[model samples]
Target: MKLAMKYIILYVNDFDKTMNFYKEILGLPVKMQHDTYVEFDTGATTLSINTRESIKEIIGLEMPASSVASQTFELGFVVEDVVATIEMLRGLDVPIYKEPVTKPWGQTVAYVTDPDGHYIEICSAME
Candidate 1:
């Protein structure tokens, strides 16, 4: 038997907006995209955005109602300039869940939620 993990897919209501949020605002590279899907190369993992209805159809399950916990996954990405990145994202109208703070892990980090409500943490290792 073979067990391996693949990509994480986020069911977004608006695919384009979500894609733009990740690509333009978050600066993740878009590896592939179509009318219904967008895939990003997130270093160690691939992240995807697809329509909610399409995702439900694929999984043969009904979509859940939006809630504080519905979109609970926290996607972390390495960043060089935490403060500057937070400011740039703020300028683009992205919600800042938390501002940059030094963590015990020796990283300066900040948090933001995507259009679909998934938390994204940006961090830089302390020198």
Candidate 2:
């Protein structure tokens, strides 16, 4: 059997801010929207955001209040120019987690923190 990615859901504190970030800031089209959930069109997979309170109610399990350790995963997005993207995001007051750097593999990559504390990787597409 093969697994296919359907959605990457983020449980966030400010649902509205995250929704608008992916919509207007990142330029992702909205596929669907609900009271506490919003899904964005991100090529093959869907990027979804939901309020932490809603997730707790749906799962009926105790969730961690916040993460105090290092980040485990990053939401990566390939763009035309890494420097341009970083500069634009910086103008909008987005937190830059890492400055643009060229990897030995010949790709440029940078990291920015999302509204909900998730790292968003802005990078050059593989050649």
Candidate 3:
């Protein structure tokens, strides 16, 4: 099947805080928004945030507990300068999971946790 669009929908407990993190902090442009949902334009894919209450209404089930330690996936972004990005995020008081460090594979990377405790990685472009 040919996929035309892609999106990662994160069910968050605090919708406004999560939305502001991606919009104001990360500088992602808003593609769509509502009282319960928001979609940000992230290059080829969209990063969407939906309230957990809305998800419960749609699916008729409660969402499971969310924790950064329990998350098995991360949202990754390729930046021109990992060090500068991490510093800027730090200045804004964003939680830094890992300081910028060069990996054995030659990529510089750092980790940050979003408002909802989702792991986000900033890294240099892969060679």
Candidate 4:
């Protein structure tokens, strides 16, 4: 058997706000969109945003509560300059979870939160 990962779907409460954040803030190109679903082209993998109600209707079960306080998962992005990315995120008024810092492992990383409180780590390889 063979399997290939394709999409990471984030079930959101406010569909429009979440969709707009990915589209306007992160500047991801929209691959497809409908009343309840939106997909963004992020190179090899696609990032999809769906409404909780939509999932509930499809699965015929109540969706569990989603919380950012759990800190269980995050989306990471590799950039050329972590500091510059942090500065740009600050200018956009994005919530900063941690300031840019170089780790002992030779990576400069900074953390930020999206509108839905999902952590986004911006990092660059240390020279």
Candidate 5:
């Protein structure tokens, strides 16, 4: 038997805010939504935003808050232009965690945070 990853569920404090952020800002189309869960089509995989309390029930333990101020992981996107993407997200008033800069590996990258504190890194290695 082979195991395949289908989806990644992110614990969010406010489902609506997180959903809208992904839908409007990241441009991920919504696949479905319920009273406690929202799923977005991220091209290759499904990204889910669920209420923290509900996530706790699913994990059978107390879930920690995933806020912009306390992010643990980053959601990454490959873009054509990291600078332009940063400008667009900044125009949307999204908080910038890091300005666009070239990494030691020679990849242009930038970082931003979602409403619930998920870091999103926009990188372009096309150069």
Candidate 6:
């Protein structure tokens, strides 16, 4: 059997804020959208955002609270300049989880959390 992942859906409390972070801040074009749901054009795998309340009501899910301190999952994005990207987000009043640090493998990486506390890694392309 074979399987392929198509979307990474983030169930969020503040749908508008999370939507704006990915759309206005990260600059991901919206692939589709509704009052409670949105999908971004993120390469082959779509980045989706939906309201937590909606999902819970629909699927009867009891999702745990969002957390940045506790380990969970991370979303990665490659940018041209890690430092510049971090600075840009910082200027917009986005909370900076970690400053940019060049890895021993030659890739510069940094971390930040979204409105729902999902960790995102901003990095330079692997060299």
In terms of TM-score, which candidate is strongest?
2
- Per-residue lDDT of 20-126 in model 1, one digit per residue for the tens? 88888777898988767788888767998888788677777776646343644688888889999899889989999999999887789999998877888888965
Candidate 2, residue 47: the lDDT equals: 92
Q: Residue 122, candidate 6: how far off, in angstroms?
A: 0.3
Worst 10 residues of 6 by lDDT: 63-72
Clashing pairs in 5: 67-117, 68-117
Which residue pairs collide in model 4, if any?
Answer: none
Q: Write the per-residue lDDT of candidate 2 for residues 55-102, one digit (tens) a residue.
A: 889887655666431377889999999999999999988889999999
Q: Tell me the tens digit of each residue's lDDT in model 3 across 18-112.
A: 88899999999999988788889988988998887898888887886564435778999999999999999999999999999999999999999
> lDDT of each structure?
0.82, 0.87, 0.89, 0.84, 0.83, 0.88
**Candidates 4 and 6: which is better by lDDT?**
6
Taking all chains together, each candidate's TM-score versus the true structure is 0.84, 0.92, 0.91, 0.87, 0.84, 0.91
lDDT of 4 at 104: 90
Candidate ranking (lDDT, best to worst): 3, 6, 2, 4, 5, 1
Clashes of each: 0, 0, 0, 0, 2, 0
Off by over 4 Å in 4: 65-69, 125-127
In candidate 5, where is summed lDDT lowest over 10 consecutive residues?
A: 64-73
lDDT of 5 by residue, 69-90 (tens): 4555678889888999999999
- lDDT preference between candidates 4 and 5, better one: 4
Q: How far is candidate 3 from the true structure (C-alpha RMSD, Å)?
A: 1.8
* Tens-digit lDDT string for candidate 4 (1-127): 9999898988887788887778998889999988788999988989998877898988777766675434688888889988988888799898899999989999999999876788889999557
lDDT of 4 at 96: 92
lDDT of 6 by residue, 1-127 (tens): 9999999988887888888899999999999998788999989899998887888877899766564324478999999989999999999988899999988998999999998778899999997
